[model samples]
Target: MQFTIIKYEIIVVSFVALLIFLLIGIAYLTLLERKFMASIQRRRGPNVVGIFGLLQPIADGVKLIVKETILPSHSNTLVYVLAPIFTFFCSLVLWLVLPFGQGHALYDFPLGLLYILAISSLSIYGIIFSGWSSNSKYAFLGGLRSAAQMISYELSMGLVLLCVILVSGSFHLGSIIESQVYSFHSVTLFPIWIIFIVCILAETNRAPFDLPEAEAELVAGYNVEYSSLAFALFFLGEYANILFMSALSTILFLGGYLPIIELIPLPGILWFTVKCLLHALIFIWVRATFPRFRYDQLMKLGWKYLLPLSLSFLLVESSILIIINPY
Candidate 1:
């Protein structure tokens, strides 16, 4: 009984630590995205808050907290109150299965990958509820778009993940990383690695796949009616989901916590962070460089292009393994 209590306490403490890290990362990611986008557009971004806008996120947080939470006259009061909370909680829960470094994961569940996919799929509900409960046309349209887009892309993303499971032969994230680690004489498997990165970007709703929040059509999508701290929660959840997806990509494809070159002797966590940041940077870069697709184009690309490609990759990988073993 005493040991169980200690274990529970440890788990709680670890979850709290992870929450802090995620919140900090989300704040900095907003700053970093603005900074990067500013440089690309030949302008300064957020320079006044602190040294080169280092404290800008904190200032923004304070402002949001102090602002009024205005409830719309026609809104469903109960769901209006609950939508952002649900969205924030869903995003936060994803970190439980994410492995940060060697022996650093919260739980080593055998079905970790499937568990993450399930949680992510469920997060769309929060967006739907927020939009519908707001009782505004813009909000309703935004919510409908988000639900359709997420469902469409999620299918392709799942197919891509199915390919990874085929190649690695396990749903455990740590095992997937171990499969990617280089041995003495064999050549590294590069094909699976490439597919994993592409899938991660799509799964996270990064551009060229950000149809859910396309400003041209939905005017900020499902959270259109949110303001002040309520809006902040949605913003935080979106960026946190980005970070979580990037971290998951690092773990599954780029060899989580493993050094890229293997010659350098850096710590595992350092490698993991660097890899995640690079992935995040790529996401931002795509947003800056590419234009959003038409809704039909986006749906076509996922269903027609990515799905079949992922399935073929799985088939080819299976054939290679059979020929190599022949028994």
Candidate 2:
């Protein structure tokens, strides 16, 4: 009984620590985006708040917290309030099964990859609820767009994941990482990696695929009615999802937590974080480089291009695995 209680205590503490770390990461990710984008555009970013604007995110958080949360009088208050919370919760919980190093995850479920796919799909409900609750035409249209976009891209993403799983022969993320000990998937599955990158970019609603929040037409989109802390919640949730996708990309292609050269010993977690950051930088770079896709263009790319490419990769990968293993 005592041992069980201690184990539960450890789990709770670990969860709290992970939550705090992720919140900090989300905050700094916004700062990094602003600074990087500003550099690309040849302008000053948040350097006024602190040394190199290191404390800018904290100031922004303070400002958002003090501002009054304005609720639309016509909005469904209950669902309006719950939507951001639900989205934020889903974004955070997906990390529970993501391994930072060997044996380092919280749950480490056998079907961790499938669990991620399932929970990520649930996040759309929050978006739909927020848009519908706002009772605004613009918000409702944005919500509908997000639903179609996510559903379209998720099929491609799932097929890409299946390709990885087939190569690894295990649904467990750790096993997938181990399967890459001799060589990374990025080499063998280069085309699939490229396709997965595009799929994840759309899945996270990042630029080129950011139709759901397009400023020109949607006018800030589904969360237009939100203000203050509520708005902040949506903002944080979006960035968190972006970082999660980056981590997923790192794990699937870059070999999670594996060092580049085994000859020089180093920590696995450090390599994992470095690879994840590189993927995050790719996301930010794409945002700076590409214009937002036309909504029809976005759908066409997902359904017409990405879906077929992913299916082809999966079939080839399965054939290769069967030939190699012959079991």
- Model 2 lDDT-worst window of ten: 313-322
Candidate 1 wrongly placed segments (more than 4 Å): 183-199
Candidate 2 similarity to native, TM-score: 0.98
- Write down the TM-score of every candidate: 0.94, 0.98
Where's the lowest-lDDT run of ten residues in candidate 1? 183-192
lDDT of 1 by residue, 104-182 (tens): 8888788998999999999988888999999987788878877777776677677667666766789998888778777
What's each prediction's clash count?
0, 0
Report clash pairs, candidate 2.
none
